[model samples]
Target: MPMKLYGVSDGPPTLGVRMTLKALNIPYEYVNVNFNKGEHLTEAYAKLNPQREIPVLDDNGFYLQESNAIIQYLCDKYAPNSSLYPNDATARAIVNQRLFFNMGFYYSSIGAYALAPIFFDYQRTPMGLKKVENALKVFQIYLERLNSKYAAGDKLTVADFVLITSTMCLEAIGLDISGYPLVLEWYEMFKKEQPELWEIAKAGMIELAEYNKNPPDLSEMNHPFHPTRSVK
Candidate 1:
């Protein structure tokens, strides 16, 4: 049986997994969960993913959550010989480090500061912006340290697939990434190199930007994850 992936149509994490699947030539079915309609909150989805997050992968009834983990699993299990996930211990370690950095730093900060304000109507705080900037600075340092065509090293790995999705989101929000020349260069290179996969991410950004044009409704307003909601 073919693998099944559940995710939002325009979700960044979903895009990352989709791109990874395409790059590895792994065939899978995609189920788009409409978060705007609260489809993810339904009992059926909760059973598939108790955490109620997008981009859940099911391989013959073996379910998995978390975008990074899914990407690594696809590469490791389906395409072990693919350089997109190097078998070399040192190279793979770098890829793993970069993936963790994206989850803990780059992606998290951007979602909190940049996306929360636009999508959830959360007020942007100075501290939040500072955190985003600091994350970018660290990304710049990582680029300098790796000094390769991709995030982890010369070849494109799952790290590039994941980080690029976050950076694409950053760009969609009109955050100027010019200060980080390496990132900008990397983005441009991938834009040309991986046109089809890049289009998958770009299409999602376009949808998100369109959705942000109008004011959100009561359902969106009342969501606990809404920007204005105070964390307990």
Candidate 2:
């Protein structure tokens, strides 16, 4: 059986993994979960991932959760020699740092500030918005320090895929990312170089924006969007 990727198409984490799979030319069956319909909360899905998150990778019955780990596993197993994830320890560490930053700081802020209100009807607060801006500023700092075309370094890596998706979602939600020149430059470069994958991400962003316009009814939702801690 081919590798199975479980997640929605436009989701940032799922999209990041999809972009990695495409870049490595790995063939996988995409199993899209309809969270709005509560498919992800079912017992069947729980067996695959107890946390009930999307973008779970099933490689021949070996299940893996978390997009960061999935992408790393793909590059390590399939494309060891590929610069998408270098074999050098120091270089790989830098990439790993960026991946963690994207997950913990960048994407988290965006979800709290913008996505929460849209998905779970959480009231947006001043601190939530500040977190988003601070996250962008920190990203800009990373871009400057790297002094390269990509987030990790001069070459594109798995980290770039993750960061790019977060950046796209950030921009999609009406944030003016133009203030960060380095970020804008890097994001524009992806549009120019990776048009197909860029469109894949853009389609998801468009869908998310539509949700913002017409908020969904989560009254009957079995598994609502509630993160561990409220944005502070």
User: Against the true structure, whose TM-score is highest?
Assistant: 2
lDDT of 1: 0.82
Worst 10 residues of 1 by lDDT: 223-232
TM-score for all models, in order of appearance: 0.92, 0.93
lDDT of 1 by residue, 21-77 (tens): 999888888888877666777779889898888889999999999999999899989
Candidate 2, number of clashes: 0
- lDDT of each structure? 0.82, 0.85
Q: Which regions in candidate 1 have their CA more than 4 angstroms from the true location?
A: 215-232
True-vs-predicted CA distance for residue 35, candidate 1, Å: 0.7
Question: Candidate 2, residues 37-66: lDDT per residue as tens digits?
Answer: 667788999999999888799999999999
Instruction: Kindly report which residue pairs in candidate 1 clash with one another.
Output: none
Residue 160 shift from truth in candidate 2, angstroms:
0.9
The RMSD of every model to the true structure, in order and in angstroms, is: 3.0, 3.3
Count of clashes, each model? 0, 0
